[model samples]
Target: MTNIKSQSWCWIEKGEPEKLILKDQTVRQLEEQEVLIENSYIGLNPVDWKLISSGGANWKKNHIPGVDGAGIVIKTGNKMKHIQLGTRVCYHADLNKNGSFSTHTITNGKNIIYIPEKVSDSTAAAFPCPCLTAWQSFKKVPDVVNKKVLVSGAGGSVGYFLTQLLIDAGAQVYVTSSKKHHQKFLKMGVLNAVDYNLTDWKNVLLQSINHNSFDIIFDTVSGIHATGLMNMISYYGHMVAIQDRVKENTLPAFTTCISLHEIALGAFHTYASDAQIADLMIQGEKLLNDIGNSKFNLRDLNISDFEQLPRHLAELKNNNSEIKYVIKV
Candidate 1:
């Protein structure tokens, strides 16, 4: 119902940056359930690159690559009564239209969650996927109070937010990351921030929590890399992975013996009842506000060079963690 324009980000096919398929396309006209968003700040999730480069989410056909972002509503469907025009909201993109990577995106109004007046757009961008994952995982298996929860790759955006959520709920959260984020992890309230560099990781964690015992593991990093931590989990302790499910571990029983929850934010979008997700978002917004007022550590975001977006996506795959990148459109 409003004017449309060019989008942000170009997906490449064969070479890293050779193909730009999403280069030309008119945005979708709004349907009754759809609302158009003017993307303010898009949160770069690891999947954005994986789905585009590896064709994991098949963006070659769909084109744009992003899932989470914060923005304002420039237009609303005629039937859309809940969110008014000019409202600020954060959304989990359909993955059909990519996330909010574009200057404009037409999304299902149901997927758009409004941000509180006190929360900044960038902070709202940081909340959706990670916060939803944290809510669903803990909500799925609720009985782990005072139980030790280990969040591997805890320094990442998702892990960082998840750690804060767990801590606020009184769960003993153990975290791991490169030495660089060790101090950063401790400041976020993790019981132990294990640096994968020095000493035996499992031994160090076990030694540190000798009396407490690790009962639940919240893994954001998986595959063979995190086998040692999987081995450290206590009997009947549950392990939920935010990244991918563990196929095999050195301690197969430890991984398989206990409860394993495959926590995917997409599941909520596809399968959750409206009432369930509503409660989560309501709670997520509250937790997001408590985390802090600042968006993320990406205050001095470098968006001047739009040409760097492709390189940024490549770097995201090669590196272990993410570098928060914002491109002003």
Candidate 2:
């Protein structure tokens, strides 16, 4: 028989090198739309560390701090129509509740999806936060089919997926990554991959793409030459940023008339209406299904045992690792 009781890695105090302790936590009774899951894997993100250090608006005292996980659904709420009791699932937990650091966690049925048999639990766990964020960012852009697009940090998690999605959709996608990964990006079917590290990399991109400006600039590495990047966008083009908020200094000239979107997955979870949230959940599910069909790859994952979450997250804070880390629960 499986254990219903769960152990959670929790934050008891705030700061760098987070004061995390594993505690036996009670699994709450399920609401009509919730499901109880036996977690198998947990994927780490910058937000997990940020919640500990900065204690953002969603951070609660003595709370677990992970958003992405894959698990088996042990119990489904009375009103859940799409999930079954024995199904394997992957999900992004709600900001208002405790997260996926626990052995057992509860999430809304709508937010969870069945993991295909061919996909490993760790890979499934890796998809939720970053892939959903990428999908939302792309949704914000208009008419991407055959449009010229540039993904500034194409080597990162969200950028990796978004670049492929844009490529699959027939967009003329270009990318920027370290020189070492430029060849890999080329094999992924991008129009061109330029080494953003070179001092003259911006000019190199312009020279390679025939001096054509981009219709959309997806800025994943925020504050890295923000003004110069925006200047390369075609007039009336759009820019989507996951991190850096555009300040007056970073904003483009008035004549350029660029459209800017700052996309945050947390904002959608916290602020969207029920209908809108449902739409996002459906869109995310479709993307996951598409990935399961082998149309895209989930690359560069760093796996660790659950016990090493804190240490791994500390390493992630330094921003040196090239891969996203996943914890086996």
Q: What stretches of model 1 exceed 4 Å from their correct place?
A: 12-24, 57-62, 211-213, 225-228, 247-257, 292-307
lDDT of 1 at 134: 65
Lowest summed lDDT across 10 adjacent residues in model 1 is found at: 296-305
Overlapping backbone residue pairs in candidate 1 total 1
- Please write out the lDDT profile of model 2 over residues 1-329, one tens digit for every residue: 33468899887778874478889867778899888889999988877787788765656667877889998998878898467677988888876688898898888887776787778889889998889888888888878998899999788788888998899888999998887777877888888898888888888899877997898989888755454588888878888887666655355367768887878787766788888888877776677777778888776789999888888888888874356999998
Residues 207-311 of candidate 1 have per-residue lDDT tens digits of: 888844578887778644444456566777777766787665445553447666677787666788988767766776666666556533322233423345566
Q: What is the C-alpha local distance difference test score of candidate 2?
A: 0.82
